[model samples]
Target: MFLNTILNSIIQIIFFAALPFIWWLLSARKRIPFTQWIGLKPWKDRSTHLGVWIAGISAAFTAVGLALLFAFQGTETAVSVFSGRGIQAVPAVAVYAVLNTSFPEELLFRGFLLKRLQAQFGFVAANITQSLLFGLLHGALFLGTAGVGKTVLLVLFTAAIAWFMGYINEQKADGSILPSWIIHAVSNLVSGLCAAYGVL
Candidate 1:
């Protein structure tokens, strides 16, 4: 199950990477650096500013809180590949949560789709669209295990978080994904840890 968990994460990361790579090949090809184009640049000056701190910290807390809520439930709603695997899965699950799950997601949604949509429709519309899509994707993934009520909650929570992530990246982080990535990575790590302990 642990090995399968890692494999599933890898598959998701690959799927996320492939979407932007295909777009890169179709448009800029090798002209624009793919990493930078996708907001993989290192920390910006504003990345450490007060506003960034507030946004990042609060969002991380919210995610962690939601995760804890589900963990307390100790039901199917607390979906994770590491679920029921116990502490033995912690080390690998921790790595996967940060690297495979959160990293690629930020790259794809906040980095690729948000920017693409922003260019075409401005920030407000773009953020909403990408957030909705992000929420829908998660909703679909959790529908079977989380059930209708929890899945609806997941969709709303995910969309709100995604929008906030995009907002911070664009407004506070100078379009860098670093802030959102860090928040996402931390959130995933905590959630994965809970799951590894069979709390979620």
Candidate 2:
């Protein structure tokens, strides 16, 4: 099982890594520099992006805080990492979750999709649309394991948080996905560790 999981995660990581370039080639037509278009450039403005310091740091903490709250009192949900798979899986899970799931998700959602949507429409509609898509993806991933009620709550909660993340990427991060990516990467790390330790 562990081997299978690792191989599968590796495959996912590769695909996720390719997705941005794929988008650049197919949809974006590669007009803008791929890195800049994906908002992978250096911190544009500290006063805006992470200049406040609190913006980036707090996002990570908030994700951890929310996860803890969910584990302790809110609707319980089972993620793939929540298996009783022993400590041996912790490192692999953390690395894969952060690289495959967290990184790609922010790139695709906030960097690519949200930016494109915002260009066509406005921030509100774009944010909501991307947030819903983000939430729905999580709901689908968890539905089989987490059941309907928990999935519903999870979707709503995920979408709400995602909207805030979108806001941060645009308003606070100066169109860079760095802030939300840090937030998500930290969240995934903590969650993966907790689940491996059977805390979640």
Candidate 3:
């Protein structure tokens, strides 16, 4: 099971990282930077984008705090960690989670998927659709380990967070995904630390 999981993750990472380039090549589109196409463009309105980024960070934390308060009665959700494994694995996992998991997920869901969906459907539909997919993907991954109820809650929480990211990403005129990526990477890093310390 562990090997299968690892292999699956590796496959997903490779697939996501390569998908945009593959599409570009096959479509024979005009020369455009991949980052822009993937919604990683430079910020146009610096102050406005920064303001929205700050507001997004605040809102995300507030929502998470409130959800935890109400759902768990102000208690920390118990987190499972590597039991017999040494602390050596913590840093490695933390780096991989932030770099591989967080970045790629943002690129795929918030960047590629969200933009494509927006072009097809409106912004709101795209945001919601991507968020739902993000949530279900995560929830399904941990279903066996976290069980039904916790996984359901996790799915809801992740979906909410994904929506926040999508909203922030679209707030920019160029649809920059940098702010959302920053937030996600930091969040994943912190979560990884908490898990390492068994404080999640």
Who wins the TM-score comparison? 1
lDDT of candidate 1 over 1-200, digit per residue (tens): 55766777788888889989889889987688888888888655643474557456656655644664563374443245567777788777776767776888898999999999999999999999999999999788767866788778878888888888888788777788877888887777677677678664
Tens-place lDDT per residue, model 2, 49-85, is 3655535555655574456446434345324444467
Arranged by lDDT, best first: 1, 2, 3
Clashing pairs for model 2 are 46-51
Question: Cα lDDT of all candidates, in order?
Answer: 0.76, 0.72, 0.68
The CA root-mean-square deviation of candidate 3, after full C-alpha superposition on the true structure, stands at: 5.1
Clashing pairs in model 1? Answer: none
Residues forming the 10-long window of minimal summed lDDT in candidate 2:
71-80
lDDT, residue 167, model 1: 86
What digit string (tens of lDDT, one per residue) describes model 3 on residues 54-83?
A: 566756744563454345432333223332
Supply every candidate's count of residue pairs whose N, Cα or C atoms clash at under 3 angstroms.
0, 1, 0
For model 3, the run of ten residues with the poorest summed lDDT: 74-83
Question: Which model is ahead, 1 or 3, in terms of TM-score?
Answer: 1
For every model shown, what is its TM-score relative to the native structure? 0.82, 0.77, 0.74
